[model samples]
Target chain A: MNITPNEYNEMAKKASPGTKSYKTIPAAFLVGGLICTLGQLLNNVYMDAGMSKDTASTVTSITLIFAAALLTGLNLYNKIAKFAGAGTLVPITGFSNGVVSPALEFKSEGYVLGLGAKLFVIAGPVIVYGITASAVYGVILYLFKLY
Target chain B: MSQRISKDTILLTNAPSILASAAVVGKKEGEGPLARHFDIIYDDTTLGEETWEKSESKMQKSAVEKALEKANLSSSEIQLLFAGDLLNQCISSSYGLRDFDIPFYGLYGACSTMTESLGLASLFADNGLLDYGVAVTSSHFCSAERQFRLPLEYGGQRPPTSQWTVTGSGAAIVGQSGKPPYVRGVTIGKIIDMGIKDINNMGAAMAPAAHNTIKTFLQDTNTRPEDYDLILTGDLGKVGSDLLIDLLKHDQIDLSGVHQDCGKLIYDLEAQDVHAGGSGCGCCASVLCSYILKRIQEGVLHNVLVIATGALMSTTSFQQGESIPGIAHLVYLSDSKGS
Candidate 1:
C-alpha cells in the first residue's frame, strides 16, 4: 500500500513463478533437432529418388510446410508447441502454422478481410524483416563487386 | 435504507437475497475439479454452434435460463438483468440475452464483470427499485484467445505465468425476498496499476487491486480476515493469489488461512495442464455461482467476502505501451444480516 510502481514491480517479480528454462531449453533442443534431422532425411530420400540436390531441398521444405499446416488444421501443432517451446517455433513448421492458424481463425470474417488479409498476421513481420535484410545484403554485395 | 458505510463501501440495509444461481461450462471445465458443482457441462466446446462467439453466447443464455428455472421464475418475471463478457462490445451478453424480455444493462469490467453486475443488482434491489434482478457474465476460451492473444492453432508457447481463459458462464438471481446468503454490503475498488505490462502475467497485474479492495472492505467494515469463513478472489490464478497474500502480509493482515482464488479452485493445478490457473470472466463467475454459493446456501459457509479482480487493459492499450490497470469489487454474502 502506497508503494511506488517500481517497488510493486520488484515485489511482483519475486512472487511470480518463472518459466523453467532448464527443462524447456532441453525440450526445445531435442524437438528442434529432431525436426531438422527429419528435414535432412527427407532431402536424402528425395535425392535418392533421382531429384537434384536443389530440387530435393525445395521438396523437403514444401513437405515440412504442408505437414505443419495439416497439423495446425488438426489442432495438434499448438499442443506440441506448448510442450516443445521454441523448438517448434524456430523451424519452418512454425512459419507454416503462423500463416495457417490466422487463415483458419479469421475465416469467419470472410475471404478478403478475414482469411486473405489476416493470413500473414503472425508471419508478416518475419517476411518483412527477412526480405528487407536480404535486399540490403544483396545491394552491398553488388556494390563490392562493382568496385 | 442502504447507507454509505465508508469512502467506497455501501451497507445494504434491506439485505437482498440470492434466489438462485447457475454455472455452465465447456468441456475443459467439465474436466476440472469443480466440474460437479456446475449445472451444465458441455463436452463439446462449440456447443454445436458454428462459431466460438456464438457458442459463448449460447453458454450465457443457458446459464441465465438455468438460474431462472431454479428460481421458478421466467425471464419476464425478472425486473432487470446486468450481464457482461470478455468480448468486443460485450457481444456475448447482448447477443445471448437479446431474446429475453428483461431490461438489460451490459457491463464491461473485464474479468470482474460478475461481481460488478452483482453489486449493482444488489444495490438496486436493496434500494427497493426492483423486485428481482439477475447478474450474469461469461468468457469462452476459444473466443477470448483469438480476440486477446493469438489464433487457437498458432504454434506459440505460453509462459508459466500465463493463465488459461475459462470457457464458461454463470448467472445469479437476486430478489427482494428469498432465503439466506443475503447481499449485505459492497466495496467498490479504485483502479490500481502497479506498472505491470506483461500481458501473459495478468495475475501479477491484478493482485494489487485485489489487495486494495479486500483491505478497504475489511477496514470499512471494521473486521479482520478471520471474521469471514472465506475471502474469495476472482481469477487471480496461482501467481496473483500468492502475490495478494504477500501484499496483505506487508500490512500485518495475513490471509493465507481463509483466502481462496477462483482461478486456482476452478482447475486442478497439479492434474490440469493449465500453467498458472484458469482466468477470464467465467473463472470466478462459474465458481462463485456454483460451489461458493452452494456452500453458503447449505450453511457450510456462513460469511464470505467475494472480491472479483480485473485487469482493465485492451490489446490496443497494451500495444500502445500502457500498463494494465486493475480493479476489484467486493460483494459480501452472509447467512444473516449485519447488526
Candidate 2:
C-alpha cells in the first residue's frame, strides 16, 4: 500500500440525471398549476356551499396548511414535494412543508426545545419579516390618509 | 510497499478490487433520475421499524447483506466491516451492522464517511491485512435530521442554502481478487477551518477544505486536472462546487470539464425542491456505488478521482456558535491499471 502522490493525481461522465441540473419546467408548471387549480376548485365548492368568498379563501388556505402538516406527520409531504419541486413550494403547501418538515424532524429532541422552538426554522423569518413589513405598511397608509 | 505516499496520499500496490456494491435508498431518492442504478429502494423510510433510527440501521444491514450477496460471497468471506453514518456515535452503522460477525470499525466523516471508510478498507485489503472487507455507510433524512437538527414534528423552514440529507445506504466489497476498477491510492485530508459558522451554508464552510485537499493532492502527486477523466467531490452541492472551482482557479487549475458534485447530482433543484441538493454520508455513497462505479465498470470511464468532502459540525458546535471544520479524502479508482 505504498506509492506516489503523482500516481494518485492521475487517478480520476456524462451528465447523469442526478448530477446535472435537471429540466424541471414542465413538472413545475404542471404541478404548480394543478395545486392552484385544486385551490380554486375548493374555493368554488365552498362558495357553492353558501360561504362568502373571503371566508372560503381563508378556509381553503387553512385546509391546505392542515393537509400539508398532516402529510408531513405521515412523512408523505416530502415525497410529494420531491416530485412537485417548485410546484409544491410556490403554493401555500410549500410553506406548510417548510414549517412541518423541521418540526417533524425535531420531535425526538423534546417538546419545548425540539417541537416548539425549531417549529419555525424555515417559516419563522417569513412570519417575522412579513408581519413587520405589513405593520410598517399599515402605519405608512394611516399617516398618508391623515395627510 | 509500506503504503506511504507524499504527505497525504497512500498508493496501494496490491490494489484491492471491488467485487460488488449495492445501494439502498429511500422513496425520494428512488424517484430521482438514477433510480434504475440503485439496487433497492424502500417505500417506507422506517423500513418497518418502530423508529426512523432503527429503520436506518435496518437499511445499512440490508445494504451490506445485499452487497455480499451480489458478490456471491457470504459473511464468512468478509474479514472486517468499515461503516458509519451521520447519527450520534454512528449508531446507524453500529446497531445496524452489529449482527454481522465481521470485525467492525465504526467511522464518522459526516457526509464524507463513504470515502473515509473506503480508504481504510482499501488500505487493509491492499496491504494483505485482510482478504476482504466491506466499506459501507448510510444516512436517513429523518434519522439524521432529528439527530443533527430538530424533531420531525416541529414545523420549521429550511433556508435556500441548506441541503437535504439523503436517506440511503451504500455498501462496497473490496477483496484480494476481482475485476478492474481497483483501489489505487488515497489522499487523507487534514482538518481545516476557514471560520464559517452557518450550518445552513455547507458549501461555504467546506469549499475551502476541498480546495486545500485538492491542492495538496495535486502538488504532492504533481498531477494536473487533465490527468483524470473525472474529478468527483462528495456533497459539495452547487454553491460549494462553484467555490471549489474558483478557489482552484486561483492556483491556475481549471476543473471545468471534469468536476462534478454528488450533492448536485442526487436531486433536482427546482423539481425536487432541494435547495442546495443532497448531503449526508449517503449522498456520495449511493451515487458513487451506483453511477460512478457503473460507468467505470462499463469502461466508459478509465481512471477517476473521488474526493469525498465532509463538514465536521455537530448540533452542539453550531449551538455554541463555533465555526465548522471541514476535511476531504481522495481515493483513486481505476479500471485499466490492473488489467
* Best model number under lDDT: 1
lDDT of 2 by residue, B72-180 (tens): 9999889999999998888889999888878999999878889999999999988789888999999999887777775554434466678899999899999777687
**Fnat across every predicted model, in order:** 0.87, 0.20
* Minimal lDDT window, size 10, model 2 chain A: A8-17
Which stretches of candidate 2 lie above 4 Å from their native place?
A1-147
* Reference-based lDDT, residue B104, model 2: 94
- Highest TM-score model number: 1
lDDT of 1 by residue, B253-338 (tens): 99999999999999988788898899999998999999999999999999999998899999999999999999999999998876
User: Estimated TM-score per prediction?
Assistant: 0.98, 0.74
Per DockQ, the best of the predicted structures is: 1
Every prediction's TM-score for the first chain? 0.96, 0.81
What overall lDDT goes with each candidate model?
A: 0.94, 0.83
In model 1, which regions exceed 4 Å deviation?
none
What are the RMSDs of all candidates, in order? 1.2, 8.1
After aligning candidate 1 to the native by TM-score, how far in Å is the CA of A21 from where it should be? Answer: 1.6
lDDT of 1 at B102: 84
Worst 10-residue lDDT window, candidate 1 chain A: A138-147
